[model samples]
Target: MAEKLLEVRDLVTAFDTEQGRLRAVDGVTFEVEEGKTLGIVGESGCGKSVTALSIMQLLPRPMGHIDGGSILFKARDLVVASADVMHDVRGDEIGMIFQEPMTALNPVQRIGRQVSEVFLLHKEMDKTEAWASSIDVLEKVGIPSPEIRMSEYPHQLSGGMRQRVMIGMALACKPDLLIADEPTTALDVTVQAQILKLIADLQKEMGMSVILITHDLGVIAETCDEVVVMYAGRVVERAPVLELFGNPLHAYTRGLLQSIPRLDRERKTRLPTIEGNVPSLEEMPEGCRFSTRAPEAHDEAAIRERPPFEEAAPGHWVEACRFCYAG
Candidate 1:
């Protein structure tokens, strides 16, 4: 069996709003194997990003917090880890690429300084050494004229180049794990493919595990080894990439798969869409969350109470609600 690099067990992350404490990541659980990629797929407001931020312990302070469960990274529980330990772990052991490079990058700082800061802080490198290391990382990410690019500001670089710089910074210390949350967002299709390929190639070269958070099933199919399908703050299905695509068990999963436009389908046929909106957190169902949005006809009573998440097959798990679990 492959070694597990990160194990998140029953993670419940909540945000304090005026209405009440709302759980954004309710009972989220999964594991990332060493040197393997895990994709967390869900629609907006399904708590995918919250789960990732919870693992990183980057939730907004005084508002968002991990209420329950453990984040075991390399066999150490991060839920109770001290600030200093987490600081050391952030860049040295786990690096993250934010969703948008434009917002993530420091606009005021030169590219070289921003990238080199990782080495300066984590590797204890001097100015000279950090600068050189940053150049090498930028070059490794396929950024041409790295030395010149390093001197330019964030605004001077193109979107693809900025993203490449972000990748360079995230991988600067060669961390054992990477968390890329929508790394290719807002980019053109061509640029998206390039960025995805770049990330895959880097993962192979660095032998690092990755947690990819995205709503794009196509990206998940192309890159992920294992997949977790989340809906309304809970995981509805999880399986090997091929297994999930070939045999989805949850109604929500099936609906999502059906909505994907396929070339095999008639060109003018209308694409299927899941009816109804995801319920607001304040109004979330006490039982199976996706029950409100499930397109399939089901016994309403079956979803009146929460169902147990059970292993339906080897390495395959689903929220086995009678209304949702097709199997």
Candidate 2:
């Protein structure tokens, strides 16, 4: 088994808004082992991105806070660390490719200079050396004319190229773990595949663990070793990729699997979709968050109290009312 690279225990992250205190990541727990990829999947507003930010200790504060829990990166607690300490760990030890590359990159700075900053700041490299190394890394990520691209600003590069630059920046220091929050969101289908392939190749080469956060199950099936299904703010199910695909136990997981478009289908109509928007953080259903849309959902009784997530198989987990089993 690969050594555990990152472990998040009972992570409870919340946001304080004018409305009230909303728990975005309520008691979420998972682990990522070295050289393995753990994909976190859920619809929008399901706390996937917030969880990623919490792990990085990059939550926008005053508004957001880690109320309870620990983010253990190689056994070190990042949740409770000081700002200065976290700065040292952010890029050097734990790298992250934000969901949107355009916003993540500085508009005013040249793309090459932005990528080189990681080496210059953390790796103790001089500007000249950092610039050279940045171009090399960019080329490694499949960017064309890395030396020329380095001097160009963010607005100058295409979306795909900008994303490649983002990947280059994130992987520059060869961090042990990489948190990719919807890394291919803005790219077209062909570009998306290329980016995903690049990431897969890089992960294999570096033996680094990756947490890929996305709403697309197809991407998860292709790139992930294990999968964690989240609904509302909690993890609804988790299992190995093949097991999750072959024998999904949770109703929510089943819905997600069914929602994937299959080319082999007899009728090529519109794809199946999970009904209802994901519940708001302030008004998450009490029991199973997925119960609202699950076809087998029994009653609001399940929503009266939180259901225990039980292991239905070796690594498969699900939370639902016992009443749903009565039939």
Off by over 4 Å in 1: 297-301
lDDT of 1 by residue, 203-322 (tens): 999999999988899999999999999999999999999999999999899999998989888979788888888899999887888877776555666667778999999999999988
What is the C-alpha local distance difference test score of each model? 0.92, 0.86
Per-residue lDDT of 73-170 in model 2, one digit per residue for the tens?
87789988888889888898889999988889999999887988899989878889998899899999998788888888999999998888888888
Best candidate according to lDDT? 1
Question: Residue 286, candidate 2: how far off, in angstroms?
Answer: 2.2
- Each prediction's TM-score against the native? 0.98, 0.96
* Weakest ten-residue segment in model 1 by summed lDDT: 295-304
In candidate 2, how many Å is residue 268 off? 5.0
